[model samples]
Target chain A: MRTKRTNWLATCFLIAGSVFLLFPLYMTFMLSIKDNKEIADSVLAFPKVWRWENFITAAEKVNYWQKFKNSSIITVLTVTFTLFTNSFVAYAIKKKFDHKFFKGLYFYFISAMFVPFPIIMLPVVKLTARLGLDNLYGLILLYIVYGLSFNVLLYVGYLRSLPQELDEAAIVDGASVWQTFWKIIFPLLAPINATVAIITTVWAWNDFLLPLIMLDQESQTTLPLAQFIFQSKFGQDTNLAFASYLMAMAPLLIVYILAQKWIISGVTRGAVK
Target chain B: MKKNNFGIYLLLVLPATILFFIFHTIPAVMGIFYSFTDWNGLKPTYKMVGFINYLNVFKDKDVLDAYLFTFKFAILTTVIVNVVSLCIALALNSNIKLKNFFKGLYFMPYILSMLIVAYIFNYFFANFWIDIMGYLGIEKWMVNPLGNEKGAWLAIVFVTVWQSAAFNTVLYLAGLQTISEDLYEASALDGANKWKEFWGITFPMIAPFFTINMVLSLKGFLQVFDQVLALTGGGPFGVTRSIALLIYKNGFSGNEFAYQSANAVIYFVVIVAISLIQLRYLQKREMNL
Candidate 1:
């Protein structure tokens, strides 16, 4: 009887929380299908006529494909380079623990984590502009650089647990240091790599302020930037704006739903550590 | 072999090293240095403005309001997010069916862009919420909260906590899973009620996660920008503005780049001090425990 009561209470809490979590998403979809008249009439009511063309109009109005491509390219490159560079640095730092520079380098990255972006963001933006790096490629480089410290921390912590014998064994078998890392250490660090990859990818994908400042061209605008511009221009058109929002958010939402298990686990583990 | 190893070390480390030097290290040093200057971000010339910007930060009503508002937002968000997430974590941690489903649903918002989330909620606050309340015949329900000064701050807090609680829920759930089931069994055997069992057993064990959630959410809330920008655009007389928004406006939109750098420096120090204090307090608690 006690167990039954606890179960009932837990189920009730779970249902309430789930509704809270899911409401906005449902509303977003609902609003996307309603015209401005329908929205003003009854924003909470179901759409009388599903306006699928709202999406078509929004897509045409904004440079949806261009911005989407820009975001995808930047995210992919940022994640790939972040993983490769940070993992390699982690391997080197871990393998060369006795080396004075590696020890200093390790501590340097760790301390760097404490320096929040705003502290450095202004100067870095100015400096990057001076270097003619105020573009998408430069933005990727900034992401890679800025992304390194935290990821290196994650990788270093993970690498510490892996047996040092792996490196020694590879080196003894005539593998170079580079080969040992790329061929052996890198593969062994896949789990933590997934965590870093997902976290960094999400950050680089959702990042707005940097792109807003640096990516000045229409061609360079990311999806979020484009959405911000679109809303400011035509935000009164609720149907079109929501449709554009859905278009901006759907790809990531779909990917997350399909790969939720891995994403959730990665995020939880990443945070707890 | 030694020569090749040295080359490999440089190759592996230099990219991150050089980039960090340019991007992270130099800018950090320069942020403080520039705070002492009058570089307006456009001209190549400026004079050293000693302590003027810092003085202005304190004297300026808007900047002080930004700080106060941010503190209120961060403190409230930290408390609400942790409590809500902890409750959800406790419920989900129980022997509930569809546990994974609920967890997934809760964390769904964390992955979506804050801009997108704010935009969606902006629509609801501007239109749907008012319409629903009017339909229910509630007096003055037509007034949008995001359009009011005080209410807009609440709207920002709500959206922030809503997105963040999911992540904290995941963290707390992970922390809860670490507590041994045997401890709970023993508590139940001692005739401890649910409240006692939770306060005695579950809460203590998850205290570290509580600290983590508090510090992280506080830090994130202090830097709140994308959501505020999208939802209110610092509207209703900038009552919803954050320090980060102030930094962005002063640095980019206005010509007070160096002054904003001063603001950023102060913001950075405050964050570091607060985080360090929290960590020290939590660590001391752990020791006491």
Candidate 2:
């Protein structure tokens, strides 16, 4: 009887928590479809009109496709480069963990995990501008570089758990180190790669500050940057702002819903490590 | 054979190393170097001021207020998030129906952009919250929280906790799964009450995770930016201005590049110190347990 009561209590608590957690998202969806007069009538009311044109109008106003393209390019390139470069470096460090140089390199990469981004923000901006890297590609390059510490940590830790014998066997089969890693080792890293990719995708897709600082041109803006500037410029249009927000977040929300389990487990796995 | 191995190692690592060096290492070094100088970020030449900027960081009221606000925000969010998430984790770890569904629903907010989340909540505070409060006859909350100095910081904390607690709950859930069910059963058999069981069994088991959540949350919150930027823009008399936002504003807009770099360096030191202290204390407690 006690166990049943407790279970009932837990369920109630969880439902309430979920409502609170999701209220803003619910409101966003509701407001996105409501005109300003309807919004002023009742903030909580379901829209009688269901104005889907809010989304169309928002997309056109923000040049949604262009920003979407920029975001996709940056996120895709950043995730891809991060996976290859960080894993390649981790593999080398794992293979040569016995060497002082490699061990020092490992520590060098890991130490960066402690440094906050703001500390390096100004100088990095200065350097990037000086190097003519103040653009989307530069932002992608920075993500790949900044990702080294955490991604390398994850990869090296996972790599250590896999036996060295696999690499040796591949090498014995006339495979070069590169071939051995790509063929035998990299494939074995599917789980960690998923975790890395999920984490990187969420970060790169949602990040606003890096793009805000790097990409000065209006045409170079990512979805988040564009939405930010849009809201500030069109501060009075709550309905349109919410519509733009909904559209901006729609891709990530769809992806999350589709791969809910993978994302949850991936995030959990990343954190617990 | 050794020479060949060295070549392979270079081949694999040097590209990443060069990128890390150029972007990460050089910038960090430059940040430190410039923190001591009077460089305004535009001029090519400036004299090294030898810790003058760091000295000004202590004397400057805005910088000091930013540190205080940031620390307060970090501490409040860290405690609230950890406690709330731990409770949610405990409830989820109990015998509940639709556990996976609830878990997925709760974790949804975390994947959304912080800027977007902040914007959504900005509207909530400005409109929905006021309406709800008016309906409830709560005159205090009838006005927009983001426009009040005290309410603005609390609102930021509330929103941060809302999104961040989900992630921590997931962490705590992972920790909860590691415990043997037999231990709980044994504790129950010993006539331990729920509170006793939690303190005696669950808390200790999840202490390591408690440490991880606390440290990570504190470190992240100490550098709070996007929420403040999107919601308050460090307004209501700049009471909600975080060190990170202050650094950005001062460095970029205010053109106090060298001074903000110094502040940034100090902020970096504070984060490292706090994290180290938390880890040491928490890990020690874990060991004692």
lDDT of 1 by residue, A114-167 (tens): 676778878888888889999999999989888877887888888888787777
Q: What local distance difference test score does each model get?
A: 0.84, 0.89
Candidate 1 chain A weakest lDDT stretch, 10 residues:
A1-10
Q: Which portion of correct inter-chain contacts appears in model 1?
A: 0.65
Best by TM-score: 2
lDDT tens string, model 2, A212-251?
A: 8888899999999999899878878888989999999999
Number of backbone collisions per candidate: 0, 0
State the fnat of model 2.
0.76
TM-score of chain B of each: 0.93, 0.95
- Predicted chain A of candidate 1: TM-score: 0.94
Clash pairs detected, candidate 1: none
DockQ of 1: 0.59
Question: What is the number of residue pairs that collide in model 1?
Answer: 0
